[model samples]
Target: MAEQDWDSQTVIRKRGNVARVARTDSEINSARRAGVSIETQRKVTGNKADPGVHYQRIAKVDYADDVVPPPKLNNSVPQAIQSARQAKQMTQKELAQKINEKPTVIGEYETGKAIPNPKILGKLERALGVKLRGKDIGKPLFAKKDGK
Candidate 1:
């Protein structure tokens, strides 16, 4: 007999398998004794959204007026800076330019209002050839050696 090809034909699935159970006498007795429905209960996996502990945040405030001011240069230091610049026949602006600083900074130092910054002081010392720090404030930075 010749085999027929089933691949070319359209197939239809009419229904799925159903079990019409006939309960045994023992099962029926047990169900009757328990008097409970056959439905299963839902399980809890403890994967819950928790609104966790909240802590109070601390706020930090800075009182600008309450802050201790930066230390100012000594009166002698300012006086030394001024006298050295004047002796060199240089204005505040000219000295500031020579030291690569603002004219206001030079003015402040001359007026005893500026803070003593080591870097600026060094620059001023080199530019003006004066000792602006220590006890000998207005002394020359490099002392004259004996004539060779």
Candidate 2:
């Protein structure tokens, strides 16, 4: 084999794992000790404390006073729901069953205690055949012409 010219040298790249970077024995020992301590702490105290240490646990702090309150359902909504349900000769439980919702959910809406949910309102409208929301509360969802 002829020696290659310096100007035309073919380079071969090395593959596989490179040598680990040098670390002091004390540093390596400390890392191992820290790992073992963490494992032991987890076993002893469980994982609950680790989240608070490694990540911000927002739930642990009281933010209720800082947070804005949820909007309450209007009094008109309760009246509309109650009247419509009664017009159909349906009890709260029967209305809830018809809508595939819990009786408490229907009761809450009827009492205007639940937070307004459009999906629930839509379900109620379809089931009770009335409009529980918008400008025409307690009106038929789909008004029919007297002739049609």
Candidate 3:
């Protein structure tokens, strides 16, 4: 008889006569218990066991059939700034004037292509009555052993 193709689950035996079992993690485990060499190959001289699953599956699925979605995130600080200015019933020119800055400065802060200076941030907060520091000060630490 032709030798069977080897899969992860294909079983091999040490001799011509032995009980056939569907190869499995538990079967390998039992072999471990009964003093079978975990890494050694031995000569077998008889009928092959039927092909079957090896590992005990927690669950199984066809991964090729999944429809995964791309991740979503926010880049909305600029839009938030614009909307807040609008809610305060101010134009770009008016906002700039109230903050004692240029309209282009306000535009840059709103678009997020530039970071606001401390003075500008303070003026914007005071003028617009909104806090722009969404930076979390109270989040839990996942610090390393050195507490870095």
Candidate 4:
């Protein structure tokens, strides 16, 4: 390419119409007062089934009223298990065999060193015929009560 005079070049131009300027605050307020909403329509697309169908607004949730709280683990679980095992005249080893768990695990539970999960707790409950887990009783450990 040959080097030409750079400043001698004429700028290309289109002559059709001038662009519209932004409206003033007073003009916008006047339009609002005349019941003319300047809001732009949001384009809704994606669903090939029906583009006119829009999503429903999410309803507010009342946590305390609408939600049911989970069962809280009672602190007396270890003692209850121990007492129930003794009441049934079953040793930790015997209880462990019945529940298909280790004797050490039973000992840990009895000594309040370990807390068993719901499945193991249920097995122990069935073997001992007691409710070892649930809401707090707020009673003495030795006080006998019906195991429901």
Better of 3 and 4 by TM-score: 4
Ranking by lDDT: 2, 1, 4, 3
- The alpha-carbon deviation from the true structure for residue 52 of candidate 2, after best TM-score superposition, in angstroms, is 24
lDDT of 2 at 147: 100
lDDT tens digits, residue span 74-144, model 2? 77889988998898899988999988999999988988889999999999989888887778888889999
Each prediction's whole-model lDDT (CA): 0.78, 0.79, 0.64, 0.70
Task: State candidate 4's TM-score.
Answer: 0.42
Clash count, one per candidate: 0, 0, 0, 0
Model 3: worst 10 consecutive residues (lDDT sum)? 135-144
Candidate 3 Cα deviation (angstroms), residue 100: 0.5
Alpha-carbon runs more than 4 Å astray in model 4: 1-74, 136-148
What is the TM-score ranking, best to worst?
2, 1, 4, 3
Provide the RMSD of all predictions against the true structure, rounded to 1 decimal.
16.5, 9.6, 20.4, 13.7
72-142 per-residue lDDT for model 4 (tens digits):
34558877888878877989999999999999989877776674577887787778777676654222334
Alpha-carbon runs more than 4 Å astray in model 2: 1-65, 146-148
Worst 10 residues of 2 by lDDT: 37-46
Residue pairs in collision within model 4? none
Best by TM-score: 2
